[model samples]
Target: MTARALQRMIHVGCRELGLDADTRRDLQLVATGKASMAEMSEAELAKLLEALKARGFKPGFKPGVEPGAKGRRPAAPRPDLRYIHVLWGLLGKAGALKKPGRDGLNAFLRTRFEGKWGSVPIDIDALRDAGQINDVTRALKDMCRRAGVDT
Candidate 1:
């Protein structure tokens, strides 16, 4: 692997393990024969990777996935807002929602998915970053199904 990729793996591993500065420094010295990872040669970078592996560090490890995980990452849960809009329209027509527009949609989501949708703000941009999109979408689908509407 390239030195840059190896460096990134090391940094990620360090952050994951919460390694202290002295431990990082010691790793740097052992890996590169230098005090900095930035200056390490390709061979040294390989050594560093090996050292990290020996310490049980799995490169590219991600939260919620088992170590040595293979295959595709889990798909994000969020659905497009358009799908939400269509589902909301159906709910509104079914007399399930009292408010109109996005405000009404937020109210519906809050009521339907209390804990998951509680933290998501009403604004579109904010909702995009809220990381609760998938839950909201699932709730919307459930609402649609309950109202006898196909999503």
Candidate 2:
């Protein structure tokens, strides 16, 4: 990571850990022997991030993806459909899927559904048959399992 990105992550960590100004300064001093981020090198910033993570500061979002952008949750309303989305996300994260998100999943579903049922739903939510839904879920779960990704 760049120095700027590391510094940004450290600041985000401070907010996530709920550290007050004084406590943050103290921690910085302890970790890098410096109180200001500007004075610390990139390595020092990473060390501080590790300390913050050890103190239970989990990062909430990825660097490029903004908040409320496409994520694990798709627009499908049903719980079972959402579970399919979650499995798709796991495959995407594992780099098993060539494309990710609703469009990719939709395209894959179209091919599979049309081949078996001779027609495809307009979207995942349009899949009304319970058997079809179960088939898609089983397919996604099998893909995840094959990719070494937990469902």
Candidate 3:
């Protein structure tokens, strides 16, 4: 995580734990040997966050989890489409994909396998053939692996 993000999480943790400013500073000094967030390094901020978590501060949804409504879970993707999106999202998070949404993924599939598939649709979910679906999945997995994004 970036230094700024880690610092934000630390602050959030402090708030969730109802720590006063003085106590927060004390915790920071004890955990990282730094009293000011601005003066702390990313590693220090992470350490402070871990310490706060040990104190019972819970963070909300973490990075890379699929987004949904405020209190509702998102519908599950089809089995064939699941890994494709998961890999694509991982690549996106790693800053490897120019267009990270469904449209971009569909475009990528069309560009990469149009000739082999005879005709690739704009919506990848439209794919019906098992071979075509597997091809798209494999291609996406290859891209993710090449980009050093774990599937």
- Clashes (backbone N, CA, C under 3 Å), per candidate, total 1, 0, 0
**Every candidate's lDDT:** 0.71, 0.85, 0.80
Over 1-151, each residue of candidate 3 has an lDDT whose tens digit, in order, gives: 9998888788777776789899999999999998999998888888899899898776885433544536433533577876677878888899998999777888888788988878887776667788888887888788888998777
Residue 64 Cα positional deviation in candidate 3, in Å, after optimal superposition: 20
Model 2 lDDT per residue over 59-86, tens place: 8765457777875554677888878888
In candidate 3, the residue pairs with backbone N, CA or C atoms under 3 Å apart (3 or more residues apart, or in different chains) clash, namely none
Q: Would you estimate the TM-scores of all the predictions? A: 0.46, 0.51, 0.49
Error of 1 at 18 (Å): 1.7
Instruction: For candidate 1, write residues 1-94 as lDDT tens digits.
Output: 7888878888887777778778987987976688887777988878877887778777766856787767463332455666666777788888
Best by lDDT: 2
TM-score of 1: 0.46
